[model samples]
Target chain A: AQSVTQLDSHVSVSEGTPVLLRCNYSSSYSPSLFWYVQHPNKGLQLLLKYTSAATLVKGINGFEAEFKKSETSFHLTKPSAHMSDAAEYFCVATKGRDDKIIFGKGTRLHILP
Target chain B: SQTIHQWPATLVQPVGSPLSLECTVEGTSNPNLYWYRQAAGRGLQLLFYSVGIGQISSEVPQNLSASRPQDRQFILSSKKLLLSDSGFYLCAWSASRDSPLHFGNGTRLTVT
Candidate 1:
């Protein structure tokens, strides 16, 4: 089964500081990984996705994630945090192109002003 | 551009009431539709998915059911509402299994 685990349930960072949200995935086959963000009472928005392409994937709102096969990790990162970036982040994994996707318990990001 | 719309952004209903939540996608054809429920800490739970009209696949056995009446329409229904059913329901669609999903704003259902 393909699954994703978010390391932190909540993360707090000062404005303009770098942010990191760790995620680890387990899959039997080549996986397609994704990062999604959801605001309060809102639907999820896809931040980025990683197929078999480049390990480093850039996304909207200055977010990025690197797929590490050896580490079984796909950690989301930002060079600096903004108040608008505060939201719930989720890590998702799928076995292949045509497979059911599994979501991780979210990581709520708090930006301290 | 593809857009997904879900009706009744927020709903409050008494227990045992019949429930119906509708979703539709525009600017796309033969898209894959999905229904998901989000609880406080359980993450996004996929309830059902449809590959085409009249084809629905359930991922979890629950009091809820889904139907795809049209190529771009997905409806979630329940004969009787339960308190446990109170959660955020989201509708989503994707061009294919490999494509990223586009989600509707979600409906906040509160069963009283």
Candidate 2:
């Protein structure tokens, strides 16, 4: 079974501070990993994806994630936080394209100005 | 470029009323379609998926059902609405295997 676990249900950070949302996955095969962000009343936007490429992947809006197979983790990070970055973040894992993608419980980020 | 549309944006239905949520995709063909539901303050739960017309796969057993009558049209239905069914329903599509799924704006269904 493919599954993802988000460590934090909620995270708060001051503006211009670094942000980290942790995630771990369990999959039998080399799976594809992804991070998605959902803003208020908006659809989920893909922040980044890992498809067996470089271990470190950079995504839109200065967001990045590292896929560490040894630890079975794919944690999302940002060097600086902004108010607009406050939203629900989801970690996802899939066995393959044909398989169903599993979603984590999600972490709600709060940015303090 | 591909787009997924799901409507009506919000719905309030009585417990015994029948429910219908429709979704359509454009600028793509033979895409994989999916229906996901999110409860209050919860993550997404995959309800159903379709790889082709008249082909639907249910990920979890529930009161809801899904159909793909056309290549890009997917519909979710229930004979009778339940309070437990009230949630945000999202429709999504993927071009091919291993591709990231694109989501619709979503429909908020409130069963009262």
Candidate 3:
């Protein structure tokens, strides 16, 4: 079974400050991890993905996440939080050929101006 | 450059009504398709998936059903709508087993 857990349900930060959205995953094998963001009434956009090749992944909108095997974490981070960065973030895990995807509860990020 | 499209961006229906949502993919062949639902303020839940035409696998048991009549077309249906069926439905596809799933714009369905 593969699963993911988001460490926070809500995170608040000031504009231009660094942001961190924590995610941890559980997998029986080498699973692929992804970060997706959704704005109000909009579709989900892929932020990043982690395969066996890369431990550090960068994504759109100045976002990035690091895949750590020792800690079992793939926390999303941003160098600077912009006002348009307010959205819901989801951490997902899936194993190849298994055709299964598991998502975390989600973390709502609030950017304060 | 593969693209997926889901129809009826927003739908409002009454209880017991029949439901049908269509999805189509372009610029790809024999892609893996999936149907997912997101409840209010919740994460996505996988409902169904298909690897090829006329082949479907269900992940959860619910009032909804899925079909893959053509290589690039996937449909989600329900004989009778339920109040609990209200959510954002998303259609997605992947090039192969090792690729990441790309999602469509999604449909917001509301059952009254």
Per-residue alpha-carbon lDDT of candidate 2 for residues A1-113, written as tens digits (9 for 90 to 100) = 77899999999999999999999998867788989999876679999999997999999999999999899999999999999999999998886556778899999999999
List CA RMSD, all candidates. 1.0, 1.1, 1.2
State the TM-score for model 2: 0.97
Model 3 backbone overlap count: 0
* Model 2 lDDT, residue B71, Cα: 100
Q: TM-score of model 3 relative to the true fold?
A: 0.96
Clashing pairs in 3: none
Rank the models by lDDT, top first: 1, 2, 3
Q: Any runs in candidate 1 off by more than 4 Å, and if so which?
A: none
Pairs that collide in candidate 1 are none
Name the better of 1 and 2 by lDDT.
Answer: 1
RMSD in Å for model 2: 1.1
Each candidate's fnat, listed in order, reads 0.62, 0.60, 0.53
lDDT of each: 0.93, 0.92, 0.91
The DockQ values of the predictions, listed in order, are: 0.71, 0.67, 0.63
Order the candidate numbers by DockQ, best to worst: 1, 2, 3
Please say which candidate is ahead in lDDT: 2 or 3. 2
Tens-digit lDDT string for candidate 3 (B1-112): 7888999899999999999999999999999999999999788888999999999999999999999999999999999999999999999998776577888899999999
Using Cα atoms with residue i matched to residue i, what is each candidate's TM-score against the true structure? 0.97, 0.97, 0.96
Candidate closest to the true structure, highest DockQ: 1
